[model samples]
Structure formats: structure tokens, C-alpha cells
Target: MSHLHRAIAFTATLLAAGLLQAGQVRVAVAANMAIPMQRIAVEFERATGHELIPALGSTGRFYSQLRGGAPFEVLLAADDEIPARLEREGLAVPGSRFTYAVGRLVLWSLDPHGVDPQGNVLKQLPRGRLAIADPRLSPYGAAAIKTLGGLGVLAAWQPAFLQGESVSQAFQFVASGNASYGFLALSQVMRDGRIPRGSGWIVPSQYHPPLNQDVVLLNGGRSSAAALAFLDYLKSEPARATLRGFGYEVVKH
Candidate 1:
């Protein structure tokens, strides 16, 4: 072979290796995780050169998709149980699931004076139109239900309910003025410890079950270098910092 031909082949091999090192990983993320996950997706690519392609929606719907053979390599669920169930069903890599964030719930309204941090507004504010995620599908929704029940307002608020398919939609229902109030993930309305352009009351943790968000490497990604690397990236200091900024409590380990 000619030297010119050999040199061309060598250059092509190096380029192929570079592409392999920067492979893309497909991730399925819950709707409520949209903001922080998008930020992480950007940073993850910048730092590691591995691309993340996220499909955002309700975890329950994603659960159905996974069972029906979606091509996602990793799942960032809004709750721990979905991923655990996937692991049990052999759809995910066993022992690959771990809590990435403990979510916080909040009652939010666009009205300037509609909400109080102490949460007495729910009792005092008349039974107007209210929004909540469908508890059967969303952990945040179930948390909202639990919080209302704990506050002894669920029974009264039942008739005024407008159910959203996901927490993101529930936030929109109130944000768009379709409802007077809504329960949402703290990450949706909060950034850097403040609620931007809205009134909100952070629900006390004692009122409901902790929203333990977990991520799992799926069986489809068992061979994906990018998938495993992204999981490792999620545990890094920069990633944890981003989560905290978005109002999520990072789970250490």
C-alpha cells in the first residue's frame, strides 16, 4: 500500500474513535424534571462530550412505553418505585437504580397575594377551582393528595378539582389562570431559593411521603458507554449543585 493511502486510513480511524467516545445516550425523564434535567443535559455534553436526548412526560406513561419497547437507554423517574419495578421486571439493569433527588412539593398561584408560606391559605381561600396532577399517575400528585388529606382539606377540595395528566400540566393549569391554585414540584416554581413571579407555600415534608426521584440504567443501555457516564455525571458536584439550585435535594452516594 502507498504511504498516502496508509496515512488517510490512520486519520479515519482516529475520527471513528472520537465519535465512539462521544456517543449519544437516550434518556426518559419525568415532566417535572424538565428544567433541571435540561440544564444537566447541557452541562453533561459540555463536560463529557456524551450527548443526552431526553423524552419528557409522565413517568407512568413512560413506564408503559418502556414495557412496550421504547428505545430509551436511561430513565429519570419522578419516583423510586417505577424504576424499582422496571428492575424487577428485568427491563432495567439490576442494581443500576439509585435516588438522585428527593423532590419537594409546593402549592402555587400566579396571584400576588394568593398564597401564604404558612399554608393557611388553603383553608381560608374558599373552595375555588383548583388543579392537581392525577394521583394515580404522578408521585407529586399523590404527594399533593396526601398533603391535602393531612391538612384535612381533601374532602372539601375534592369538588373543585381539575386533574392534570402530569405535574407540569398541573402547574400550567394554575399558571394560565385556569385554576386558582395548583400543587407542583418545588423545582417548577423555584430557582435559587425564590419563587419567580408567583406566590407559593412549600409544603412541610411531614405532610406527605418523600418524593424520592430515582434514575436507572436500562437493559437497552447495557452496552452504551454514554449511558453509564451520564449516570456518573449526575453524581458529580456540578450536577448536584444544579439540582439544588432548582430546588431538589440531592441524594448523596
Candidate 2:
């Protein structure tokens, strides 16, 4: 077994023996996951009596904060690399990292006919801004660039680019009609297992690298019973179901 799994097992033993008390766990979650996390947190808190305190932002920003000694106990990142880097740097528990979800990218607009199913709207886009998250900070934003590049429209759309610090903000740019369209995480626009309104084209996964969203137990949380229990709860069926409801792909445990 991985060291983290063993540790979690031991922690479970302690809990079963009534030696551990429920407490709060501070978590850093990617902005794209904020809504789903909120739902899952409600259920988790009700079931386990453990409070989850979440800080939502871009993965890159969280990495910088963690490097600067942020006191977050767990990380649910938008991409796999940051968690891997944390493990390598000893900021997180080695072997405690795992991909919790695979993110999907979408081109979305508030108008019903704003985007075509095949995303051919880019070929003759209207004269307005095209929103995207900052590629340097958001995996979804990076995927947007890759998608445009693959379609050979990067140059054509360069002048109209409008960048947001995170995918959630990019969605806002489009949702508020400040931009004609925005590249966003599927989760941002999904509801009831589908896109509830406006128009969106789900970008094919091949357009960019797989957005393997991973979660890790940070070094600071290794000794916290609540943190350990939270990690275990994340792999439960209820949590995985919540992830899927938001259009994120979850790996079978």
C-alpha cells in the first residue's frame, strides 16, 4: 500500500476505536470546482460532522501560496502537475495524491445560438471580445489556447482576446455579455447533468492534454484527523456522483 493509504488506514482505525474527534479541515479548491465542492461539502459535513473550510482560486495561485507557506490542509487542484510538484517538494504527503476528476473545456455564450456544435463559429466570429482564462494560471485557459491553435484560429482571434484570471471569471465575462463568447470549464455552465441555458460547444478532449484534476493531503494536514477523513470521504460514491453531476469525469475506485 502507498504510505498515505497506510496512514489513512491507521487513522480510520483510530476513528473506529473512538480515539479521534471530528474537526475542521482547511482545503484549497480550484475555482472551477467551487460549486460542486459546495454541494459535496454540505453532504460531507452532515454525514461526518467535520467542517470543510475551502479557499477557491486558480491552481497556479494556490501553488504560489503553498510555496510561501499557506496553511491549507488539502489541495483540490485544476490540474495534476501542481499536486505532483507539491509532493516532490515535500509540501504534500507523498503518495497521498490522486486524480479526482478529469475536466472538460467548453466554448460558451449567453445567447442560444452563440456557438455551434462543432465550434465552427470561430471561423466567422462576430466583432467582439473572446474571453479565456489566463493560460499561465488556468488549465482550462491553456486548453482554450490549444483548441484555438489546433483549429488554426489563434492568429485570427488574437486581437479580440479577453483574459480572466480564472475560468470562473471568464464565464462571468461571457455571461454578463462583456464578451461574445468565452472558453470555460464545462462545470461552470453545467446544470442537472447538462448545459441548462445559453449555448456551448464541448471541446473535444484531444484538443489538449487531459485535465487530470488531482487532490492531495498537504504536509500540514498529515496529523489532522479531520483532514485525513475528508480525503477518504472524497473517494466515496456520493462525492464521485457529485463530481459527475457537474460534468467532471471521475475515475472508478
Candidate 3:
């Protein structure tokens, strides 16, 4: 087993023997951050003995759940505005918000040569289908819409667009061969510090507003030391490095 798995095994033993003190924190995370979050959660658990229960979905849907008292202690949203909204609505801790990463959007396809680097292929998009997250629910989706518009193809591509409930789902549609191509968070398709397989173009940031993904401590989490610890851990070098590994730009804060 890896070091972390061994540590977790030892932690379980200690827990069974009533020798370790640990706490659990519930986290609501955006779909785009799923992969990195899973790895980060494991590392955080091994390092601090805190358990993270992450629920991933669209930021808008997660926000609605939080507002309805879903019992999440923290949220890593796809956009800064939702966290700020939580603060304004007294749903989150007054000042525990900060940008954790800046997301980069990508135009990707499962076929190795499906997408051209210059993105000229997008101009003559396939008749098959193109996927994107629902613009109303996901920041990535909104960014995708903006990007298509900025490229002057939104009007032409409307009929061929397939909207997924979340960015991950949009990626899934393409990865599963249900769609010819899709726009997704760069992290979704990145592996080993590169686009491990398939064809994709890192969408220019100039095409859309900055995707300043933010995290916040919720009111339900105010009393959880584990929640506070997780927030601190998120700003640590290890966590930032993991985000970088997923092709995200960690925002120093």
C-alpha cells in the first residue's frame, strides 16, 4: 500500500482502539474540482487525521442545497460570486472566503486529432454534437458560452449544443463518445501534467471572464475544527501543487 493508505489503515486501527482524536468535515465541491479534491482530501486526511466527505455538483445547485440547510461545512465553488452570496445571506462564515484556484477552460475531444490546436475546427463543428455544462448552473458552462460567442460561433452552434448538468458530465459525454467534442475545465482532461490522451486546446482566457474559483467556510461549519483545518490545508503548498498538477493555477492568498 502507499504511504497514505498505510497511514489511513493505522488511523483506522487507532480509531477502533479509541486512541486517535479526529473529526469529519462535509464539503460541497464543484464538479470541475472533483479529481484534485479527491486527491487533496486523501492527503489532508493522512496529514491531519480529519475525514472529508465531499459532495460534488454544479456550484449553483450546491449553493441552493447550502441555502436549504444541507449541512455542508465548507464549499469549494466554481465561482467567487456564490461564496460571496453565501456570506451575504449569512449562510457562510463572515470572512473565511478566498480564491483557491483559477480554472482554465479547454475545448476537448476523445479522438486524438478531433480538435485542432488553432481551434479552426470549431468553426466547422461536426454534425454529431458538442457538449457543455448548463450555462445557468455552472460557471464553466457560462465561460464556454462566452468563449463560443467570443469566437463568433454561438449563434451557429446553438442547435448542435448538448448541455450537461455539470462540467464533469459535459466531459463525460465527450469521453464516452456521446458527443464529438466538449468544453470543460482544463483539470478534467489533464493527467501527469499534460493532456494525457485525446485532442484539445486550452481555451484562451481572453475569451471569458476569469474563473476565480473560491472556497468558504459555512455557518454550519463554524464549530468544526476539522473544517478550519481543511481550509488551512487548502492554502498549503501540497494542496496548491495538486491543483497545479490538474492544470489549474493556484491563486496565492
Q: Which model scores highest in TM-score?
A: 2
Model 2 agreement with the true structure over 77-119: per-residue lDDT tens digits: 9999999999999999988888889999999989899898888
Tens digits of per-residue lDDT for model 1 on 106-178?
9998997888889898886465688999898899999999999998988888888999999999988998899
Task: Please report the candidate that would top lDDT against the real structure.
Answer: 2
Give the least accurate 10-residue stretch of model 1, judged by summed lDDT.
Answer: 3-12
Please report, as a residue range, the 10-residue window in candidate 3 with the lowest summed lDDT: 2-11
RMSD of 2: 1.4
Candidate 3 residue runs with Cα over 4 Å from true position: 1-20
What's the lDDT of the predicted structure labeled candidate 3?
Answer: 0.88
lDDT (tens digit, per residue) of candidate 3 on 146-215: 9989989998888889889999899999988999989999999897589989999999899999999999
* lDDT scores in order: 0.87, 0.90, 0.88
Cα lDDT of candidate 2 equals 0.90
Q: How displaced is residue 156 in candidate 2, in Å?
A: 0.8
Off by over 4 Å in 1: 1-20, 125-127
